[model samples]
Target: MDTFVWRDDYSVGYTPIDEQHQELFKRINAFGNALWEGQGKELLAAHLRFLADYVVSHFQTEEGLMTTHKFPLYEVHKPVHDAFVQEVSSVLNRIADAGLDTATAILVFEKSCDWTRAHVRGMDQELGRFLGAQRNSTAA
Candidate 1:
């Protein structure tokens, strides 16, 4: 699997959330690189641990903001986050049980990267627009 690259086009124009998303991409990419480089199982496991923690925290932050703003799509958007966490947990469990193999782990990691990009583009961008418009309306 190729490394996931962060592109400016993914920005949602919300500084805090955008920064968090960038950090997420960086961590995930680092994990992928480490996996590809044939890092030791212990090291790769550590990276995956961090990734899992960060993903949960980041999604919660975004969800909290959406709830606070009463974003119309919050209900729809939340299930995506829940589903992602479940999927990541399942992968983590498998790795724990079956032992981490570079090929298998890398494939799952790449799928996650793709999911992140698509989610940011599809759901996150829309949420960002909604939040931004709300801010502008309040300011006016």
Candidate 2:
């Protein structure tokens, strides 16, 4: 499995958001590591729960900032967040409820990592650019 590493380019121009993103990666990486180590359900579940819960909190922070700043693309962007939350929530729930076999565990890690990389590179980078432009304009 490809590990999630925080890259300098991943910064979204905001310190808090960037920090949270790094933390998100950290949590995901921990989850992957636990799974790879063949850790038992309790350990894996703890990491998965952390990922799910942190993601929800992080989304709230981003959405709040977008709303406060009146980000032009917020309406378009928010649904992405909602969908991700639902997806991750379902994965976490499935693990919690029915327990995950080896295959399912790997699937969860792959899905989380793939989605995160794409979203950060695409929609999130756009938001970061918008925020940066807004800052520059206000400074001028």
Per-residue CA lDDT of model 2 for 34-108, tens digit only, reads 998898877788888888889999889988989988999999999999998888777777777666667877888
Q: Residue 41, candidate 2: how far off, in angstroms?
A: 1.7
- Which stretches in model 1 have alpha-carbon errors above 4 Å? none
Q: In model 1, what lDDT does residue 29 have?
A: 85
Report the lDDT tens digits of candidate 1 across residue range 1-140.
Answer: 53787788899878888999989998898889888789977777778878889999999999999989999998899999999899888878877855667777777787878899999998999998998999999999
TM values, all candidates: 0.93, 0.92
Each model's number of backbone clashes?
0, 0
lDDT of 2: 0.85
Report every candidate's CA lDDT: 0.87, 0.85
Model 2 bad stretches (over 4 Å)? none
Among these predicted structures, which one has the highest TM-score?
1
- Could you give me the TM-score of model 2 versus the true structure? 0.92
